[model samples]
Target: MMRAFKSLFWIEFKLSVRAMNLVLFGLFSPAVVAVIIGVIYGAKPAFDGAGYSFMAQSFGALSGIGICATGLMGLPLALADYRHRKILKRFEVTPVSPGMLLFVQVAVNFVYALAAMAMVYGICRMFGGGWEGGSFLYFGLSFLLVTVSIYSLGMLVASVAGNIKTANLLCTVLYFPMLIFSGATLPYEVMPPALQHVADIMPLTQGVKLMKNAALGLPIENAAVPVAVMVILAVICVVVSIRFFRWE
Candidate 1:
């Protein structure tokens, strides 16, 4: 099973790269954003009193962008396409289990998201930015928390969506808005009061805030709320996805 899973993962990963959507948005885009920011800001403090480089301050938000692309967009679309083509049903009759396909799909997207984040971090380093002293571990944990919560939403969408069109619609609705308003592509502080209020309601925004503090070595006050929100979202989404998942 392990060997079969690995093989499937490799194949799916290649297919995803060839398709280019995941590669463009999940892998290249975030890294590009990081490079652009690093070149422009180059170790500058995020703000007058922030004391952290702009790259460090933006790390979490940039990482969240990869997750949004690979999780909310890539994962669901892959699942929907597999279902639409009856590849999942075909898997039931082979040594390769349908569940393996599901695992492979998720695993492939997870790799894309993480690899993109690592590339972004490397680019940050090139521009003279890095995580605070002894802070990378905490930053990683925070990033993982956000990734799991967001991926669960992708699974939920796959379970509910009957076709690629529906998956694309759901992904676009969640993906674009999060990228724009969650401080992934845009600075959160620039948003006005009303928009800030609205952005605060988004899970990615809270996740970004959590990750940003971790990356910056800043005090993370009221962290319980964000943690709880992510945990609850993951639990609910995973449960519903399993119960309603369309294997065929």
Candidate 2:
């Protein structure tokens, strides 16, 4: 089992690396955005010494983009392609179980997510000052939570999509709106109150808020609602995906 798992993991990892478009948007996009934001706001003071430095906040927000790109776009498309091509069905009779395939994909994509986050963090630290509001541990944990939550949503997407075309369509529908309204592409503070409320209901918005608060080292009292929302969303999506997922 261990050997099979290891082989599956490496195969998935290789396929992920070969996916140039996913690599570009999922990993490099965040890094590029961080560099741009850092250059624009590198001189700004920390927000009254109570909020994140502008660079830090930008990094936190763009991190969500990476997560969304991977979970919302990359994972679904790849998995759907496998199903469409009947690859999962072929694996059913082998020592490598369909569940193992799912595990390998999730694990590989997770590594991509982490690498993307790290790249964004490194870029921001180089151009702006390093994270000024929270301890490394706090920020890391928040990032991990947000990634898992988004990845769960991706699994749900893959579960329902019956073909590659459907997966891509669904991802497109979910991806653009979430990216635009979830405070990933726009600063939340400047949004209109109505739009802010709408954004608040989005899973990625909650994730972004959690990450930004952690980056700023803000008091957790105001962050409790988003934290709860993210946790619940993660749990619900994971359960639903597992229950409904089709290997063939």
Least well predicted 10-residue stretch by lDDT in candidate 2 = 43-52
Clashes of each: 0, 0
Evaluate model 2: give its TM-score: 0.91
| TM-score top scorer | 1
Candidate 2, residues 1-248, lDDT tens digits: the string is: 98888988898888888878668888898888888888788847646663446777777788888898988888888889989999877876687654566567778777777888889888878876547657567777888888878888888888778888888989898889999999987898889999999888888888887777777677555667777778888889878887787877
**Once superposed on the true structure, which residue ranges of model 2 sit more than 4 Å away at CA?**
46-52
Candidate with the greatest lDDT versus the true structure: 1
Model 2 gets an lDDT of 0.80
lDDT of 2 at 118: 86
TM-score of each: 0.92, 0.91
38 in model 2: Cα distance from truth in Å? 2.5
- What value does the lDDT take at residue 56 in candidate 1? 77
Stretches of candidate 1 above 4 Å error?
94-100
